[model samples]
Target: MKRKLLFGERMLLGDGTEAFNAVIPFRLRGIFKEEDIQHALGQIQAKHPWLRAIITHDENNIPWFEVPGNHLPIPIRTVMRKGENDWQEESAKEWQTLFNYEEKPLIRFIWIKGEELSDMLFVFHHCLCDGGSAMAFLYEFLQILDHPSAEIGVESPILGIQDVVPAEILNNRRQKLKAKFIGRLAATAIKCIPVSKKAIERKNDYLIHWKFDKETSSELISYCKSQEVTVNTFLSAAVLHAFKKVRGNAAFNKVSCPVDIRRFAPQIKDDHIFAFGLMIVVSANYKINFAENLYAMQEAVERKTAKLNPYITMMVMESAHDALKNFTKLLKHGKSSNDCMFSNLGRIQIPHQYKEFTLDTIFSPSVIGPLGNTTTLVTSTFRGEMDFSFMGSEGYLPYSEALAIRDEVIETVKLQLDPIAVL
Candidate 1:
């Protein structure tokens, strides 16, 4: 069986010159045998068909995921653990390691073997899955490892655009013409515009991670509830403020937040391993107080979300496949407009307890691509504590500035919880 790649997936694959890797590091306190991991991976592969699929290009150079008569298993590499932060260094290295798309699956594993504790990094081609889908796979892997008899159901993923966009919408001639016209116009415009001969150099990428204690995390949650806004909104506000303070007047007030398309498109199940992205850009008013700025950002988020039409976006992208190269060029050569991309997976509901091993901590996943800007912050809370993974290139954001921004972000959140500080 073969299926065409989605717009976002195609963009991620790029020209096959660079790797677009997404890695999630899981910290486990107890022993996890290699055999058990292999068994769990086998089970996961059997359940998800895409796990066994390889990428092949058509005569037109478009990428397609094809499952031939025989498929290869996902590669598993074991490394000796030198220290606690060894996984971080390895993950960074994996960002540049390109996958042999024709011969193997787009996902792989790196296990850091330690005496007492271990870290497992789940690395996937960004075209294969998003953070939500990756988290689902992680949960299932742990479940199967803990209990061999556990029943992790199979997934029925959308195979093509027809599966997502309704027949009525696709069948409408006017809608089809409109999409085609828009696509052609975009392609022509992109060709007419002059692009930079030398793309921005993205070097010295680094990830800084930290977590808030349970009490502090709980207090922050309570404060968000009292203020009638989500923890995500508050965090977005803090991120904007921190960037402005650390990067000085050069920082962009705008921040891009990715919204899970699954929310708007009910047809796409939670377990589906799709990679298309729907994002809303939010900006803060630095002229106002922090609390007021947060509320304003929250309102803006609500307005943008309410207006989002995933179906139209999907159709438009499907018609614009020819513009993929132009989009990639713009991404690589464009100047950084937004300060950073912020994504909060919110509270992770995955079970931390296993029959044999217990999960110690779930670090926020960090991903960096060859795309121009490397500034990104990913947050996820597990077992009532919030964890953050901040990644950026030294060329784009100085290491010293990133450290200051990280500290300011934490303090900004804490300041909201402190009544004296608010006063």
Candidate 2:
């Protein structure tokens, strides 16, 4: 099926910035041979249409997808080498490792076969897909690997935003008014804040990861339940506290949290479209105790988020696409005081048994946005454990400090429930 890309995805392609690129690595075990991996690639090519697509430009200079033919290789490239330092050396390459490809949406595969288990890294431009789509592709690829005789599933067609919104609906006066209001609010919010000094200095440079075992993960879930708050609320509150501690600012405030639009709108579920949805920013200004502050933060986030869901933002954006895009570029280049971005995928459900292999820990590197010197935290829960990974521009913030802040967040949450307990 042929479908247009989402507005956000289209914008990413238009800007042509490396910040929007996505890399998803899957650590696999119990693999037999190289041909087994090769066969999996063949099955993936047959199942996904994007794999065989090439980027073509229209008269307007906008890029769009075009299918070359059935013979097009699934955009998969293999790099096989023998030596201990090979994997270590290649992994250290630049985050946005460019591949020599004629197509706009380039998909490349890097395979490193070690002594016992093999590692597969899938890199693709964000213009084509998001983390969720990448994970779906990985899951399917694993399925094909487990059962080579299994029939490859039919490809899912891409559905564009224009197709989802009819022309008549786009012309509605009420929708137009709503879009105008949202755009004005977004613009005002951007103008009211001062650009973060750290962002201005361009000192962000460290990236670190912290994981919680099953026991600690369970404790966190229980703490949230007892506190009558969602996991995100608890985590966000903890992050605020940690920032206050490290920054030594009692007046700490402003956080950008990503809200997924897939469930907010049925039309957004189409696998082909890309959407950033609404950024829920929680303001910190009132004076209160640590626990009360957390509660206030939770309430602020929930209230702001309820005003307009992801669908509303998408509609607003669709109506004022050009204006919003221009405004966003200006904000990025100017001194804007947007503190950080926190994204929670909540929990991921992988099948207990994929063919015959057992699913293990899934780690996702944070996708940096166009704005420099921003802190992004992405969390995913799997197998009763929650994994939080932090990523930011390496020159503006120290990774070691950010990691310590993450641990402090986790520890503070644990202490709230069990003060005597060790996390």
Candidate 3:
């Protein structure tokens, strides 16, 4: 079985030179068997067809998820845990590890084994899965690992664009004409735009992670509720504020946050391994007080979110498939518009306690690609504690300044919960 790559997926698989990987790293304490880990992966691959599929290009060089009669198991690479930051070092390396898309599944696993505690990293090609779907895979792996007999129902994986966009819409004559016209216009416009003459040299990417205790996490949630704003908006406000303070006036006041398409498209369930994303860019109004800024950001988030039409966005992109190369170039070579990409995987629901082993910590997922800007802040609350993984490159953001921005973000959050402390 073969299906054409989506527009977003095509952009990710561009030239396959740079690593476009996403990783979910977590710590577990107890005895683990290598065979058991392998077995769990087998079960997951059996249920989700994409986990067993490889990318193959046609005569036109278009990528497709080609399923062979007999698929090979996803490969696993294991390393011995040396220190507290072993996973961090491995994560950095994983960002440089490109997927062999033509041969193996677009994902791999890295195990940092220790006597008492072990860290497991699930690394996937960004084109293969998003954060939510990755979390689903993690949850299922834990379930089957803890109990070999556990059943994870098979996923009727999305085959192609038809699965995501309803058949009725695709069949509508008017919609078809509109999509074709837009696609042609976008492609022509893309051809007319000038490509960057200067090549931006690639830089070594880094990941920094930290977490807030349960008390602090709870305080943040309560504070956001008291202020009538969502945690996402509050974090966006803090991130913009942090960049402005640390980078001085040169920082862009805008921050882009991705909205899970699952929220709007019922066709793509939580279990489906899909990678199309819709984003809303929120800008901070520094002229207002911090409290007022939060509210203003909340309003912006709500208004933009309401205006988002995932169906239309998908249709437009599908139409602009020919312009995808230009789109990828535009993203990687164009000037950086947003200060940073802030993603909040609000309140992870995976179970922490298993029958045999206990999950100690789930570091928020971090992904860095060879794409243009490297500044990103990803957050998640797991086991009652809020965790963060900040990834950036010195070329884009100096390590010293990134550290200051991280500290400023924490301080900014605290100031909201405790206003008097700011003085």
Candidate 4:
């Protein structure tokens, strides 16, 4: 199976040089056999063609995902577990390590072997899949690892843009004209936008990890429910408030949030391997108090979310292929306007207890890319506890400042939890 890379895929793939990878680190409590791991991976690879495919460029130098007659199996590198922090160190190394896309698949696994407890990290090129896709992969892997004969269904992959946008919408002449006009206009504007000839110096990339105890997490959830706002909205407000409090005038007051395309496009299934997703920019109104800002931000989020049209957005982006170079240049050299991107994966549904092994914990996934700001905050609740992974570059956001911001976010949430009922 083969298909030309979509615009969004190409942008995330880059020139196939630097690493734009995502990692999902998790701990499991059991004795895992090598054969069991190999069997599970083979099943998964067989189920998802893209997981076993490699990237190859054609005449015009456009990348295509091609499944070869004899593609290599997904490689697993096992390292002795030195301590609890070994997975973190390995994850950092994986971030800087470039995938050999020409020969191997775009995904790999790192096994931190230990006596009783083991930590595993699933690393993928950002071009191959999104967080939603990765989590689905994880859930399946566990299911199969326990029972090698597990029946995970095959994926009817997305072949092109047509798969996502309906035929009726694609055939609409008015929509076609609008998409073309907007695309060309965007391309022209990007060319005219002033940007630094040199890229922003990303120095000393770092990750700061934290977690909220079950009690605190519960209280926060209760508070958000009481306010009639989502936990995501409340956390976004807290993050923005933290930056404004710590950085003062330097804060951007904006946070970029990725809207899962599956939510809008039913054609894009949870099992489908897709990289493209819709995005929304969120910001707080400083004129209002923190609680007021949460309500206001929630309203803004809902309004912007309601306005999203994945079909039109994809059409516009696909029309702007010629602008890829200029658009990438702007992202590489343009001034940073947002404080950071905040992603809340919400509650993970994967069971922690399995027949053979006990799933200990699922950490909040971390991702780093060369595009735009490297500062990002990701959170997800697993086992009734909320975990956070704050990743940033010292050049983009100093380690000291990032540390302070983490503390501030926690404090801000704790303050809001004061009024919530314990029961």
**What are the per-model C-alpha RMSD values against the true structure?**
1.7, 4.2, 1.7, 1.1
Candidate 4: residue pairs that collide = none
Mark the regions of model 4 whose C-alpha exceeds 4 Å error after superposition: 421-423
Residue 289 error for model 2, in Å? 2.8
Alpha carbon lDDT at 263, candidate 3: 89
Q: Each model's C-alpha lDDT? A: 0.87, 0.61, 0.88, 0.92
Q: Identify the candidate with maximal TM-score.
A: 4
lDDT at position 84, candidate 2: 40
Give, for candidate 1, the lowest lDDT window spanning 10 residues: 414-423
Candidate numbers, best TM-score first, in rank order: 4, 3, 1, 2
lDDT of 3 by residue, 1-423 (tens): 779898889888788887889989999998998999999999999999999889898899899988778867879999999988998998888888888888889989999999989999999999998999999999999999999989999999898888988888877888878888887888787677776765465566788888989988998898888889999999998999999999887898988899999989999999999999999999988889888998888998999999987776788788887788777777777777788899999988999999999999889999988678878999999999999999998778888898999999999888777853333
Tell me how far the alpha carbon of residue 207 in candidate 1 is from the true structure, in angstroms, after superposition: 0.5
Deviation from native of the Cα of residue 273 in model 1, angstroms: 1.0
Residue 408, model 2: Cα distance from true site in angstroms: 2.3
Total backbone collisions for each predicted model:
0, 12, 0, 0
- Candidate ordering by lDDT (highest first): 4, 3, 1, 2
lDDT of 1 by residue, 287-403 (tens): 889889878888999999999978778888888887887878888887788999999999998888777888988889999888778899999999999999999898788888999
TM-score of candidate 3 against the unseen true structure: 0.97
Best by lDDT: 4
